[model samples]
Structure formats: structure tokens, C-alpha cells
Target: MKYTSYFFIFILLVAGCSDSELEPDQSIYGYEYFPLATGTYQVFEVTQTDYLNTGEVVTSDFQIRHEIAESFVSDEQETFIINRFTRANENDDWEYLNTWQSRRTEFNAIVSEENLSLLKLVFPIEAGVSWNGNSFNSLEEDTYVLDSLSFPFRLNDQGFENTITVIQADNQDFIVSLDTRFEIYAKDIGLVYKEIVNLNYCADENCLGQEIVETGIEYRQALLEYGAL
Candidate 1:
């Protein structure tokens, strides 16, 4: 009888341990991090800066709106949320730009933009989790490493309760020969901030002569407002 009782206690302990791990945190739901319901939308202030080989610098600032237009199912039965992108100057009307699509599965969330569908986030967000966020794009080899899954973040003077910050770069040092981008998302809100730095410079292998001329781009977008419908 003692042996049987010990066996039962062992089984109870094992069950309890696993149940704790399996239970969802209920605090960091995937949907809260990136809500995709129809009528959800966000507005951003965008700044574009460019450097020319002629030593000329050009900078422009504008506003953009991203709104969830609708939902559709693919041939494979996967559903996606369509976001309409529109842009305008400070005092001008918004001009339709393009549409982007994104969807979330049990394992990860994927967003299609700039003609490529790429993984954006993974479930059970925790620090140190890494993934190739730009695998679909062939322009440059890139990877996104999550620095803090629950980073404390503030936007528009409002503090977020939960935020995820991902650093997208070509190398581990947060630097690449081509470009690097940073994206931050908040709970129940989509991307709240983004910054992309692109560099285009040509030089010889030995780093001698003709390396004087270079061109590049710097872009930033910060969320100004958002709403969920």
C-alpha cells in the first residue's frame, strides 16, 4: 500500500508541474500584441532622409495611415488581414499607397509588405528568441533578434503595459553593410515605432581609393494614434 501511495503522489506531482507550464499566461496573448480585427487602424508620423553621392541631403516629413480593410482566406484556408496604407503631407489629403497583408498562426505571425511575406513575431514572446524575420526577401540577408519581449515602452507620451522590441539587422552587432531596422510593437496595438537605416556605398576589397562617394537612406515612423473597431 505504501508503494502504491508513493506512485500516486509521483503522478500527481508530475501532472501539477506540467499543468502549470501548459497554462497560458493570460497576460501576453498573441492577439493583444498584434490585433488584426477589421476596423483596427493606426496613424504614424513618417520622416524620410536621403544622402546623395553629390554630398546633398534631402529630408521630408509626412503622415501615414494604416487601416484594416478586410479579411480573406487563402487557398490553403489560412486567413489574412488586409491593411490599406495611405500617406499625406501635414496639410494634404491622404493618398492611397499600397496594401499589406498579415496573419498569425499558432506558432508565429507573418506580415507581407514590400512584395515579400516575412515572419514578424513568434508566440510566447520572451527575450533572446531569434528568427529570420526577413527570410522571404532576397535583397539582403537579414535576421531579427528579439532584445526584450516585455520591454517597457512609451509612445505619444503614453506608456505601454507590454511591449516587444525586435532589432532587425544583417549582423549581430546591430550593424550591416547594407541596412538595419528596428521595430517595436505594443499590446492590443500593432507596430508603434519603426526605424530603418540603409546605406549604399561602393568600395574596393582593399579599401583603397574611389570610396569617397556614398549614398544612403534613413527612415523613421512613429505611431501618433490608433483605434480598434
Candidate 2:
């Protein structure tokens, strides 16, 4: 066997170390999976279903868009990323909606909208990992669990890609109510689809035993397009 030169061995070692050094830049890696930079935008198609007390169910569909409007650091030394969200029906002009802000700490990514603040995502994503996302919500506590470690999910026929889907309230009491949510995120992209179904029902005077009469609402939001600017 021929002996290798010290210069060649040193060059190979430097190349390997250069790649390993990238792990220290947390921001870059995190942002690649969930971009929060300014000018990034994503559009979604929303479908809503509402059940009235009169045994009537109404369904509506619309489009919603969220844009990263601004990014700044507060005096508390926390970086806040602002997002402008809007929605409209088909062939209709987009109406301005409210704004929201998000920031990431060492453990979690939090989003604050209106008077509500909650955990949106947990860092170091892995399969079987779970967290209490609704700890900050005054209304109720919710646990967000990762169902798929690496899944091939298709969105709007956009072709299958590696993705992860986190589910909240996966188990439901169908006899009384259903408050379930599923959020799917694609690698190197943001939220691809979100489905929230809130249905609370009661029995009517003429209904059978445990039969549902009045229902609440169901909402579904799916990604239409995404871009980074």
C-alpha cells in the first residue's frame, strides 16, 4: 500500500470540519424549515362550515394570505416578526385583517395575535416529540404532538414532499363535541395545511337517545401558494 501525504490528509480533514461547523448557526437552520424573514408570504384556501341551532348547516370557502410585514427587536431583547393577514372570497378584493407576531426562544416558537399568545412550534423537531402548546392559553390547555417524523405529504396537488404533521386533540368525543386541529408543515417551507373542526352538539326534543341536534362550526385552511422574498 502506498503512503498518503500529510498535506492531502490535512485538506480532507479541513473539508469535513467545515461542514460540521455549520451546526452552530441555529438561526439559519431553523429558518430553513420555518421561514420568518420579512417579505415571505403564503396563501391558503379556507373552507368553513357552520351549523345553526335551527338544524341548518352553511358552508363557505375563501382565500387567505399572510405576509411577513416587519421584523424588529423589542427593548426586552426579544425579536418579534410581524405578519399581516388578509382574506377574501373568490374573485373578490382582499380585505385587510389583523396582524400577528411571532418569536422563537430556545425551546419554543410563540405566536401572539389579538389578546392571545400561544406556542406555535417546538424546536429540534423529531418524531414522537410532544409539547404543551396551549400552556399560555387562558381558555384551555392543548398538547401538540408530532405524528409523522418524515412523511410524504401532497398539498393542492403540488406534488409530494417531505413533511411533518402535528395534531392537536387527535382523540375526540364525537358524542358531545369535536375540537380538533391538524397542522402540516413541509421541509424548507412553512405551514402547508391547517384544519380546525369545532363542533358542539346537543340533543333535540324529538331526537333519539344521544342524537345530535345543533352543531357548531368546522374550518379548514390549505396552502395555495408560497414564496420567499
Q: In TM-score terms, which candidate is top?
A: 2
Which residue ranges in model 1 land beyond 4 Å of their true spot?
A: 1-29, 75-78, 136-141, 170-178, 201-213
Q: Model 1, 108-147: lDDT tens per residue?
A: 7888884898888877677888887766566565668888
CA shift of 207, model 2, Å: 3.7
In the predicted model 1, the residue pairs found to clash are 32-188
Judged by whole-model lDDT over C-alpha atoms, candidate 1 comes out at: 0.76
Q: What is the C-alpha RMSD of each candidate to the true structure, in Å?
A: 5.0, 5.0
lDDT of each: 0.76, 0.74
